[model samples]
Target: MAQFYSAKRRVTTRQIITVNVTDLDPFGQGVARHEGKALFVPGLLPGETGEVTLTEEKRQFARGAVKKRLSDSPERVPPRCPHFGVCGGCQQQHASVSLQQQSKSQALSRLMKRDVDEVIAGPEWGYRRRARLSLAFSPRDQTLQMGFRKASSNELVDVHQCPILAPRLEALLAPLRACLSELETIRNPGHVELVLADNGPLLVLRHLAPLSAADRQKLERFSHSEGVALYLAAQSDTLEQVSGEAPWYTSDQLRLSFSPRDFIQVNDAVNQQMVARALTWLSVEPGERVLDLFCGMGNFTLPLAKRAQSVVGVEGVAALVAKGDYNARLNSLKNVTFFHENLEEDVTRQPWAKAGFDKVLLDPARAGAAGVMHHIVKLLPKRVVYVSCNPTTLARDSDALLAAGYQIRRLAMLDMFPHTGHLESMVLFVRE
Candidate 1:
């Protein structure tokens, strides 16, 4: 027989009830209840009394909005950014800074079904190290606009200044727009990446077609005068550095290296803090063996290698592995090595399968390394640190670890993407 609740269910209106939100949902929505049914209130905080109107009704839950705030949390403060709510970039802007951190912690606990603490917090603002923005140019109006998508639609939200960005990076929006309109035969400019280094900005433009000789020359001229290292996305998923001396670039401290297409954390300030937190949680001894999975350009691998006896970073892409090796050699890191192995796929048959390690660090993408987690649980290290961008998968894998006799020791929420609702969390476990 089929599952009892798997079939289609009717959609009907239910009695709308208003209650004080007391917690956060897995997706960072505020939690309230009416008639004992869970209500997800977006842009709300705990201890806030609000009037909620139900829009949809489901069996286990419903979604609602605050029509009015009857009372506010003592911790509440007005969001600093103007693009608050309209832009999909941040969700907790309506909440106070302290509550944003607490919401993330509570969300982790709710999702993972485990206890987590809030012992650590990263910088509040000016933390974003990298950002990607979508572009839209209207030929009829000869208009150029670049920003993120709106909250519930495919439309782009026009933003002149982002409160969370480094002031230097935010200052480039006007000049960049001026330069784009100078192009002769441009149809569409899909995206622009604002990569911030210690010196200044490295602007990466995603052009839908090849730039004419004149536009290319103009871009080069702008780079020379502006001190902005200009790069052009020659092909889809390809980044070619044009003005910078090196084909590959370095992070602010050069602690990590990245290619144009390779993924990097959005918030640089939070990233450094997160990496440090993982290293602290691991507590690497001088001779401890550690494995870094889904390691991108030795972000954590190199730092972990400094303390550990030997560290091996394995990635799916050979090019990234090569770059990681180069980064390790350039830094004169003697104990770190990198290998190309697809952690997304079943990696049980790899050459490093049997080797034992004292600790393991997982820095997978949004999909959350489920395949690797299965293989990793077998190795059974003394400690495991999971760096996750997605909480649902973290919860799923944490459940697996719990079944295998591991207890969560510490957890933290980093506000990597400030104005947006995106969450970054770190969890540590010790074998029970």
Candidate 2:
């Protein structure tokens, strides 16, 4: 018998296929079924038909780019930013704000298995108070390119003006780019962070190499001319203030002083409203002891202290814990205390956990508080508020509370990031 070799099948990466979008995913991608697999098409809206070219293919699903739309949805609207489709900062700019929120709300509701009781929103544009722009130097052009990363790629898209940024920060982009382009030792710059604090605008430049004296003076001059606080980050952990005072933002009548690298909510107006709403839903009593988990820089802890008998804030980052303490002192909040501990581990053994809390409030990261959900149950707090930035994790963590006989008293969708796919929410769980 002769041995014969057969040619292997070839799979084409790019194939145009007509798709009828039945729904929109949480990330603003259109949902359609193509050849028994879920097809995700960008820039396509629900109730729209489009020709999509498959860009990525996997066993269970596929992602594609919209080649041509056969039909359009009434809810679709024009994106405001010039860099809307290219920039990765926002995903739902093409859709109307109402449509985006509705899609996100439906997705969240399906995951949580409950109807969202309320929706809290703020200004759609000019709401971002903080943003970090990527910096790269093109060797061919001998010019510094400053902008955000392209969607799902490392390539940077040069952004002239960001409509979502605060007015003051947006205005500084051109001049700041000009100033950075003139710097000598900033060829291999890391990134530039622009923050509009309550006091003033702040600029933090991350430089991999040491800056020369002349470059420092130039930066100082630019900072003075723009009246923006400038900080130079020579290392990941250190920041040297080249000009201006420390930055702080006010919330709940308390001043929170934070370093430039600290994690603060990007939206100022929504954050203020979120804090107020969280407080209102928590309903902290004057004589009740409260616990705030994953509390960074006392965003919620200090406010709870004003109403509660005493409030304890537990944070993982030591720097944020220190800032929390500092902010507590700055606000003259004597009833609150800050503790630095890894919340992922068993925090029930900590001194702060020993004293039982009447109520608990947790504002966790996108990962949610899987590690602390069980611990919160053991504490037997009468009421618990969970502030989540990721709905999947929130739903997973909510199981623990529900299993422990806690009922969701209130659930509200927080539109912290208007145009982005980031779905923030808060839920109040009352022990039955």
Candidate 2 structure quality by residue, lDDT tens digits, 176-284: 9899998888677899999999999999999988888888989999999999999999998788998899999988988999998899888888888888988998898
Candidate 1, overall lDDT?
0.77
Badly placed stretches (over 4 Å) of model 2 are 1-13
| Candidate 1 residue-wise lDDT, 1-432, digit = tens | 332343344354544466888886545588888767887888677788887778666778878877877887776678787887888877776666666666667767778776677535556776675778888887688787778888788999877778777777787877777787688645657688887765567888888877899999988888787778888887776877789744343443454556655666766667777878898899999988999999888888888888899998999878889889989988888888898976766665666656778899988888887777777778788999999889888887787788888889998776676545677788998997
- In candidate 2 the C-alpha lDDT for residue 402 amounts to 99
Which prediction has the highest lDDT against the true structure?
2
Q: Please, what is the whole-model Cα lDDT of each candidate in the order they appear?
A: 0.77, 0.90
lDDT of 2 at 405: 99
> What are the TM-scores, per candidate, against the unseen true structure?
0.88, 0.95
- What range of 10 consecutive residues in model 2 has the weakest lDDT sum? 3-12
Worst 10 residues of 1 by lDDT: 1-10
Q: What does the lDDT read for residue 193 in candidate 1?
A: 85
- The C-alpha local distance difference test score for the whole of candidate 2 amounts to 0.90
